[model samples]
Target: MSSLTVLVIDDEPNLVRSIQFSLNDQNIGLHAAYSGNEGIKTFTTLAPDVVLLDLGLPDQSGLDVLAQLKALSPDTPVIMISAHGDTRTAVKAVKEGALDYITKPFDIDELELLIKRCGEQQRLSKELRFLRSKQIHTQRIIGNSHNIQQLREMIEQIGNSAAKTILISGQSGTGKALIARSLHDIRFNDAPFIEINCAALPEQLIEAELFGAERGAYTGSVQKRDGLISLADNGTLFLDEIGEMPLAIQAKLLTFLENRVYRSIGGGKERKANVVVIAATNKDLKEAVDAGAFRADLYYRLNVVPISAPALSDRTSDIALLVNFFSEQFAKQEGCKPPIWSDDVISQLKTYPWPGNIRELKNLVERITILYPGQTAMPKHLPNEYKQNPASSRTEDSNYSSVVENKERELILSALSQCGGRKGLAAEQLGISRHALKRRIQRLHIDL
Candidate 1:
């Protein structure tokens, strides 16, 4: 990765040069300006990843500079540097939007760690903001089937009410998360909608990531930080795949849901958040609870307003609507004109039982857009799986090899199709070597 561009604004040349040398050796880019006016001017041009502003400057006070820089780019992370290490100064700087306060005699290693942590946090926050804005501006539930209608109605009612917890359950790729986002949108304000995948992180990290951790709370936790729940105060926190959460974390989450109060991993004053937590999963919680994989009490608490997402096969009538919508969407995304779908193609799609549901359909359309943008989508343009008799795609057969081979073939074909017939790119996308991809292609008798 490229180094972080850090702007250092201080009148003291010795400290500025020392930091520049120290960070440069660590592959962190640094820029310096001695006066406040010069610092602000340089900042406008550099737009660095982080700013280190000294409390005392030659031309103006650092507080005035901090205010201007914030007004210019409010999301930029700024750390206040001062000789006075008083708690009052630290609190005032933080209250005025500085990320942290560092005394003049700060350790270089400590500063580096702080810079990395704060920089990474702001980057993640900015990315989430971009994605949320894009979603808010362009995407929504597209189908109008009875199932989708009921979902919209549920979202409307939930949005209008004061429901704090919602449980969305459905098969994989059936847009359970989308439904969560829908619920968020209905009651949308300036509050954030934070999402964390329970299965994505290790058990040890999930608690800290959720409720937060103090300095020295865990290995590598160099600085105190706010968790997703805290960041999402007065907003929404979408817990994706909550069924996969660790048993211990599940217990803690249940407690928080019960009373809105939680303690950090290292233990501090009890904190409270007023965010709506929407948990979604593809698993049957009742079965999980019965099997002892999920807590019964937690399951009951989450299932208060249970919503079941409909599979694509259950709403065959909406196939065409979804396909066309996905086509136009991927087209605009890939910067190509939308492909035209024939009536016969639509009929064939409606016949298939989409095990992966809406997600599979969406991925296929995106592949088509990349492969044959602006062209009419004909039956021949369909993947081999789509061309097969929909009845044969059923999983009722006990032949394990046949099912695995079919799925493998579809996966390879989709990768190749998405990469425009480039073996290297396809292999990369499949997380396999080019040689491996060749062997599979030959073994599977893939014509491509």
Candidate 2:
């Protein structure tokens, strides 16, 4: 919450004074240095949040000073200020790790905006580093089972390889998206990892969303849009529920995958995007292809580096670790002490068939953490379904089936209400598809 400090390194006294006066009432602390040496010394001592260095300095070359500053603190964001004609020097500074560069006589408002953006970037970078460090300490793939170990080894091998197109197949809630993210973060941490759920968007909008649109491409188009493909250039694009993508869009995506080129919805020029595509789906692509629901060519292309995320039921040995991880995570979020998981609770959890996989376990842990923080969790603390035998619980008791059906109905209704009756949003919240939700509604005979 402290005011962000900015260090300016420039020789022009008038310019420095003007900058200082301009930012005096802006709630930002400004420090000025007239030469490169003074700037480096002040930078080392003060450790400002952002630095504005002039490409032309009095004592030493600004590039050298920038290099030294980066060597000292690589995380600090440094913006270069140069004369209008010194574009070459600005480019050089940027190549040498400068965050960005601005020409002289820049608008004060624009400079302030740039400084704020730099500060936000610094904050996000710090948070990402913290998360990465924590992940290193705590395995992202948390399981000691042989299948899990082999899966982890495969992930590492694929991550280290140069495979661009990857296909991740698993059941719903088995952490396919997590595996996709892990693959992206492991290889390209500095780039964006954009995710798009194919089933979440309607057929009318998915194409525009993927390939972008011009101002007049559609009814609501008021401005030109850069789609996920363009935005994910030089990064990774995760296509979730890839089997649900419309057949028409599948062809376009296939073309893009083949050539890395795509055209906007209503544009003439072809745009290029150098991106890695990681597609995931719970449905079997082979089945979809055989049924003519998915393109065979696209499936072959994306299956270059296939990886399967194991279901939680298959990796029951990791139940305790995952429980602790989720419990501690939820406890931190709720500002409470983490719960102690008794052996009985772990055994109970290990026995339950997690139909929703890791996601279900995480939700259960969060629910328990919120309801019984700082207490020891035993088998009795679990939900009734988990406490009962899996097979007999569903088949033997009519009341139990009724209770589950009522719960399902309530969940569907709640999701629909929360989404303002938007079927796509409701389906996403319920972790199902719009078509599936329609079928459920018809089967339940729920009145809208």
Instruction: Find the candidate with the highest TM-score and give its number.
Output: 2
Provide the TM-score for each candidate, comma-separated.
0.58, 0.59
Q: In terms of lDDT, which candidate is strongest?
A: 2
Q: Give candidate 1's TM-score.
A: 0.58
lDDT of each: 0.80, 0.82
Tens digits of per-residue lDDT for model 2, 186-250: 78859988889999999989998899999998899999998999889999999999999999999
Q: List, in order, the clash count of every candidate structure.
A: 0, 0
lDDT of 1 at 323: 73
Model 1: residue 106 alpha-carbon error in angstroms: 82
Off by over 4 Å in 1: 1-139, 391-448
